[model samples]
Target: MTSGYGHGLDRDRDPLRRYLSAWIGFSAGGHFSQALSVAIVLYAFSTQSVRALMGWPGSLAVLGTLVVLATLSLVGGRHHIEWHGILPVSLIALFGFMGLSVFWSEYTWATVGGVAYAVGFGALGIYLALGRDLVQVVRAFGDALRILLVVSLSLEVLSGLLIDQPIAFLGIQGNLAEGGPIQGISGTRNYLGFLATLAVITFAVEFLTRSVPRRQAVASGALALTALVFARSPATAIAVIVLIVAGVALNALRRAPESRRSLMQSVFAVIVVLGGALAYAGRSRLLDAVDATNDLSVRSLLWARIRELAAVHDIVGWGFVGQWPTEIFPYSTIIAPSGRPHETGLNAFFDIWLQLGLVGGLLLVVAGTLAFVRSWITASGHPIVAYVWPALVLVLIGVTAVAESFVLFEGTLMTFVAIATIAARKRSWRSRLPQAAGR
Candidate 1:
């Protein structure tokens, strides 16, 4: 039998075969795959816009459709898939624990829905990581982010310049005319800043890899930086600084002689550890420098309340509702100082502990740590510039996760899953096992 294409007959001779071949190709890694990836990224990131425009049901419908399409795409492309040890065990354990929470959750229905929601996005992430090469993944990310950033800025212009009034539905405060703290379509300035930072990393990587024209990459990078500046997020400011340091460290490691690379890595690790200690010791000053004291003060209060609540169910947690179900008992009880219901625990670690318990929190930390370690190792050793994207992105996500639980939700969760899976596929010990027969 033939291994690929035609299946022994000329595709043109058999219309059904031609169509099937086209479908398979499209689903596997052709333009359809890329387009689907962009759609997923765009939808994941613009969830607020969807929710605002179409309501919860509509947003759920869109998510469900994307999941279904991702599944079909994976299945249709199954022959092209390398199924052996494709998923990271750490992620598997984490999600498995989330599913287990269903058995103990007071809100069983909510747990079920949350697990399903997370799994759907997880599946899409896996498809993205497995179906496309790293460069393709980066390109898809770049395309989606370009659209999001451009639209966000355009809307800001409309709200702040054209109409000179807030677009309340989309959360545009018409603040761009004042040089912004603009939220864009992300619903909050911090999230907009986070997305902008991601764009900058992705665009820079694209330029380094020569994936697109140098001019286009530079313009995209500039646009992302502009958004980051206008968003005025202190957390993002810190993340940008961390990213620059990580970038430099990675560059140095990659360029070191093979014999000294390991030693250099050790030195870098020591430096990072000492730097972290110093940062913590000077935390007050750092926060003041970033103008983040007010924000941290608010979060401190919220976190204190969450800690008290978490102690009530310290081991297993209130039970894994991915996003805080605001109407629920404990979550409903935890209101902000402004009398607004808190949507998340603000910190991903805190959110995990609150919902999934200490065990789940540990699992999350393990998963993230393993992913970062593996990606960092791969990036430092791999000659291709494309490999650096995952490592740097993990840094962005990890740093941002300190103050925002976006890592637990749609876009960020999906990206994390994809990066984790990609790194695992490259460096997993299980790769030594004999290949499985079929996907």
Candidate 2:
């Protein structure tokens, strides 16, 4: 009787142990982890569509699910993670400041929610950086962008050609037939253009690295260019010009002798500074050249109001709301000329100042600057074509942030976190410590 009872207990324990082992194996599988990474990217980029189709509750559910899966994968693959120098201290500082803002926030609950949202995406970004190789991350981005762009174009064709009406639900204007200014799945032409620009970079990297077939890369590039042309966003057009110049500079630097590369970098920095000054001085002409004069007029009005209001909370900020809680005080008062309540401050820097104050704004600057510098250096020295992707993506983000506040929320925020993490992992000084030496 005693032996039978012991055997029964053993059988019960075996089933539980087997189940745990299977879950660990599944989560640790290469294919499973790669698919999850792609899914996270896809969901991040398609957040607008997800919200539109499934509502906030549904979208949040999806985000939560991805976070859970990512956590599981990381745990299962714990052996691969280099914990010594994984995350940049700058990022932690910024996030910690955001959390601390809860004390001073008038809208405490909103700030709490906002911080949670920001951290959720930040965690997902960390997962991508730590869990996959840089090349694998690029390929995942390529796959996700390909699917998103194709769907965006197909939806445009359906609404603009077949139905001859807007898909108001998805914010698609059905303007493809009208020689768009199309809004694809991103809800605005500028956003679509931005995504297309990112896709162009990713697809190019994919081609350069031979991560995907040549024909596929060429076709993807063509598709991205098509989306960009139709989107007709002056901001994105400017970003593309900057991207081309940066790409040329990076290529040149990469080919230069190692000793001279430092001098070349300094020269490029001076040129960039001078170019920015010249662009500012020629602002009127530049605006006219891009047909963004009207857009500028609208933005100037909003920015003026933001400056006035931001002066009220110039230090710590009103709170850490990522996307503006337009229903609240101050934010509610900043209406666009079109009578619509403004959702963002239009400029990311201004938005940060208004929301998180100068402290948060400075933190952001430090984080972004460090990330770019590290990525640029890594790309210049590394032979792999894949390293170029992070640097170029940062350029796009920095340029676009001047006119749009997308970097502070959702997909752009997540991308920034991932790239920053990757750059830190590669170039952080902490990596030299004995604990991190092998990693």
Highest TM-score: which candidate? 2
The number of residue pairs in model 2 that clash at the backbone is 0
lDDT of each: 0.91, 0.93
Per-residue lDDT for 306-349 in model 1, tens only? 99999999999989888889998889999998887899988999
Model 1: which residue pairs collide? none
Most accurate candidate by lDDT? 2
**C-alpha RMSD by candidate, in order:** 5.4, 2.4
lDDT of 1 at 341: 86
**Backbone clashes in each candidate structure, one number apiece?**
0, 0
Give all TM-scores, in the order shown: 0.93, 0.96
